[model samples]
Target chain A: MDALVIGTIIKVVLVLLIVSALAGFGTYIERKVLAFMQRRLGPTHVGPFGLLQIAADGIKLFTKEDIIPQHANKFIFSLAPVITAATAFIALSAVPLFPTFVIPESLPLIGGAIVPSVIADVNIGILFVLGMMAAGLYGPLLAGMAQANKWGILGSARTAVQFLSYEVVTGLSVLAPIMLVGSLSLIDFNSAQAGGIGSWIIWQQPVAFVLFLIAGFAETNRTPFDLLEHEAEIISGYVTEYSGLRWGMFFIGEYSNMFTVSILAAVIFCGGYGDLGFIPGSLALLLKVVFFFFLMLWVRASWPHIRPDQLMWLCWKVLMPLAVVNIVITGIVVMI
Target chain B: MFEQIAFYLFSFLTIGLFLVTVFSNNILYAMTSLAAGMVLIAGFFFLNGADFLGVVQIIVYVGAVMALYAFGMMFFNVTKVVKEKNTSNLLVLFLGVSIALLMVIMFLSPIVPEAIFASVPPEPNATNPEAVGMVLFSKYLVPFEVSAVMLLIAMIGGIILAGKKMDQSLTKIEDEIISEKDVK
Candidate 1:
């Protein structure tokens, strides 16, 4: 019992550290990618190649003044960022980072079980992630409403609607993969795709993969689906009223979610951490991670934000039916 | 024993959140409370040896349904709406409490006679998807088909309701443009 408690704590801490670092690096990468696209140096001022730029930004956010609007709901305002960052962090616990690195034992204390490589390889890991993502909407929604600003409310409204609409497609898209693997545990799903490139799920369920990717972008509030914070209209959206570390939490939460979705896409379709004999598995995993991260940046740089109606139409009219078809096809293939 | 403990814990959490959902004045707070409650209900399903159902509950209820509720609340102009009161009659509340107590007593009265204190054993290989699929497709096929149809209808309904408003606004814009052209 004591060991289990300690292991859970350790796992939580490790996950937090890894996710925070990923978020920081993701921010750095986004800046560099955007800069490169715009033909300029991104961040040459902080450290070597601006690597420490994230750390410097962290320091600035932490040391900066924290402000609360006069008419804001103080309690909900304080809680919003906490909910956002915390939900994003918790979702990582269920994601299998590597194929074989899961903490094996069901007990909390034993950090290294010979089992799969995840924090808690729960039987319903996928559901847990979905639940966490669902809970994640609260932070922005609450933050926007509590701010008493019209822009914040509008931003929050857009985010809520956009997320809810895309979530259906996300759920349906994942169902095809789940049905094919016959398991809800992400670790099991990853293992089922163990063979190199040929065994990747994307080959079999290309439509589902595409749908999941698009829904994921929407879920993470990335550009091309970022109607929530359309700068030409609502400045900073739900984050308009936040400043200092509070705002930083929302920013970090966004990056972390982006990383989470990329990692998920890697795991689900890109043969997570799988090496096709060209490089070591760990290196392959890192390459995949970096590749997906760059892909996100590329999309951000290349695509323009979709209008709200277009975003909704893409989900309902385009992705939803396709996801349903993917699931039926997978079912038939499995039976055959 | 652990499962029993987990069941009770999840039940308590679910009930607590449900109460908060009912009592909270703010729609957002109520929705959050309801989401938390639904998640705990999923936990309860897990304890009941329904792993697949538990996951589905979490994914569909807490993920999709609750998100819709929260988004609806955010978009609707509910700032000036007053909170509703708990207006059940005293006699009705008393009757409800008494009836619940009586049902609990009656259910436990028979079980008490058997001295059933042993922990319920976990089902072997209960996590296998094949078993779940077989039962779901064979025994529950009718209900399953019904649910699929219902969901399809709901999807169509959502699209119509949400899209119609946008269509109206677009038509209004077109009409205004045509009127401006005529004036010019």
Candidate 2:
């Protein structure tokens, strides 16, 4: 029990450090990807292939002036970014990232510690994750509200409407898979698809997979659905008044959410971390996450932003009904 | 030991947040504190091992409900301090005392019914959600269905109320725009 607690602490620390670094790295990758798509060299000045760009950006963000707007609600304005970053990490607690392993018995200090994949193996893992992510809307909503800028207010309003609407689609789309697996735990979903690529829930619930992907994009505020900060529409949106580390926190939160959504897609729909021929489970999971991340960037490069009204229409009139029908079909099939 | 510490910690925090919600002059602060209190109440559900209920509480209350409230509250001037209406201290005290007494009774009532709890022991092997499902679908099914029906009715009512004059309002502005264009 003591070892378990110690292992969890280590895991939590590792997740925070590694994921934050990855989020920073993700920005560099996004820049490079976008630059390549636009037929240009991205960030070649910093280091080889601009590998040091992330470090430079980190230094810049850290050293920059932290400005709180004169008219802003000082307390909630500061509290907002922390909420964003904190909730994003907290949501990751239930996610089973990699497979579990035990330390060697011969190891000195933390020997024989069995580290689980998830930080907290809560029985209702999926719901807890969704709930935490759902709770994450407060970050932007409050940030925009407290900032006292017109753009910020608009951004918060968009955040509320967009996040709240897509949340329904997200839940309903995942319901089909939940029904098929008859378990809310991601590990259970992983094991249920352990038979291999053929047994992936994606094949059975294609509509759900599509709906979930669309909603996931909206939930993470990715391009096309990224009306919250659509540069053309609203000038920096919620982060219009934010500067320095506070702004950086929102960026980190977003990138981490993208990773979370990607990982979730890989785990639930795709054969999560399952071995494929010579490729090991961990490698497969990594490859899948990379592909999903690339897909997001690719879509950003290729697609144009949808209008807010169009977004609302698509979510309500189209995606939601489809998700509901898919759930019904899956339910009937399961019952049969 | 961990559970005991968590319970007391959550209890104090929840109470503090509720107090903030009640007494804060800024509507934003009040709403935010209320939302935080709701989340902490979910912590209590989690501590009780009702993980499903806890998650539902967070998702429904903190995520969806408070979000709507926040959205509406955003339209209000947050800078202005909301003045509380004057009330008799004795009446307020009486109401507070009665409410506290009622809550105490409700809490004690559950513990006093040891026999009722023993009569319907939860399945040892079943997970929390599964056990809840069993009871909800079997024993309390009627109440559950009735409440669901009630909710559906409430939803329809809300939609009707909101949608009633929406188109007319939209066209009213549109007609005003057309008339101004003609005048130009």
Candidate 3:
């Protein structure tokens, strides 16, 4: 029991540290990618090709002044950011980081502690992750309301609509794959796709995969669906009043969520941490994560943010119906 | 021991928030508190090892429902909704307290019958959602279908209510009067 408890604590700390560092690194990659696309040098002077720039940014964010609007709800404004960052990290607890491992018996206090890939491989892992990510909506919603700015309210309203509508599409689209795998655990999805590339659920449920990806983008507030904080109109939206670490917390939440969705997409549709030919399981998983993360950045660079009305229209009229049909068809096929 | 501690923590939070939700004069605080209370209940579900239920509770209640509620709250102009009430607060307070106490008793009686709670007998260590699905589809299919049909009806009713043709559905007497007036 002691070993189990101690091992779990170590795993939790490891996940929190690594995922956060990767999220910071993701920003650098986005900037570099965007810079290259726009023919501009982005953050190159800080370190070797700006590699340590994220570290510099972290220092700046931490040291920056924390500002609160005079009329704002003092408690919730502060509470909101913590909720965002906390929920994002909490969601990671359910995500399978890599394959499970049994500690060598030679280790002292926690010898032979068999660590599961995920921190909490719950029976319904996907649902738990989705729930946590969905709960993240409150961070922005409350933030906007608490900020007491017109733009903040508008941003919160957009966040509510975009998240609520896309949530339906996300759930429905994933239903087909969940049905195919016959389990809600992401590890099960990985195992179901273990028969190499051909066994990937994406090959069978391309429509669902596409819908899920689109909804995933909206859910994460990525570009083409980033009406929540479009600088051109809403003046940074729900985060208009926030500064310093508080603002950085929202960004971390978003980037971490982006990572989560990428993992979900990769695991459920693309082969997860499953072995691909001579490549190992963990390496394959990492490659998929990189691809999905890059895809988000690429889409951000290429696509324009859709209008709020258009986002709602697409979610309800196009994606929802498509997801439903995909589910029904998959259901029929599975029954056969 | 762990479960007990967690249960106490979550339940305290849930009830504390619920109290604020009811007693607070500020609409926004009340609504926010309600959301917090709902989320804490989801935590309670997690502590009970109802993992799927926990997730669904958060997703459905806190994520979708409370968000929608917040959106509705934002849509209404606050000044219009914030008009002070001039009712007899003292009487209302007494009645409210009594009703709340009655509710506490009613809710606790079945589960807390004995000195100890051996009430909630443990089921097998099967996947909960799967077991729920199986039993719901097999034994309780009728009630399940009935509730589903109820929801469908309510949804259609809402759509009809939201339509613009209600005024055009005047009875024959009104239609005849309109025609007669036009003829004159």
Q: Best DockQ goes to which candidate?
A: 2
* Tens digit of per-residue lDDT, candidate 3, span A206-306: 99999989989998899999998999999999999998999998988999998899889999999899888999888888899889999998898898888
Tens digits of per-residue lDDT for model 2, A193-230: 99988999999999999999999999899988998998
Q: Lowest lDDT 10-mer window, candidate 3 chain A?
A: A1-10
Q: Give all candidate RMSDs, comma-separated.
A: 4.7, 2.9, 6.0
lDDT value, candidate 1, whole model? 0.78
Model 2 ranges with Cα > 4 A deviation: B87-94, B103-120, B164-184
lDDT of 3 by residue, B107-172 (tens): 888786575573434458658788667767877799999999999999789869865653343343
How accurate locally, in lDDT, is each candidate?
A: 0.78, 0.88, 0.85
Q: By DockQ thresholds, what CAPRI class is model 3? A: acceptable
Q: DockQ: which is higher, 2 or 3?
A: 2
**Best candidate, lDDT-wise?**
2
DockQ of 1: 0.35
Q: Using Cα atoms with residue i matched to residue i, what is each candidate's TM-score against the true structure?
A: 0.85, 0.93, 0.90
Off by over 4 Å in 3: A104-111, B67-98, B107-125, B161-184
Comparing to the true complex, what docking class would candidate 1 get? acceptable
Candidate 3 overall Cα lDDT vs. reference?
A: 0.85
lDDT of 1 by residue, A1-336 (tens): 566556667768877887787788878888998999989999998789999999899899999999998877677788889988988988888887764655556667555655346777777787777767767877888788777788888887787678768988988998898888877877777778888788999998899888888888888888888887788989988889899999988887888787778778888787776665878666776788788778878998988888887887788778888888888888988999
Q: By TM-score, highest first, what's the ranking?
A: 2, 3, 1
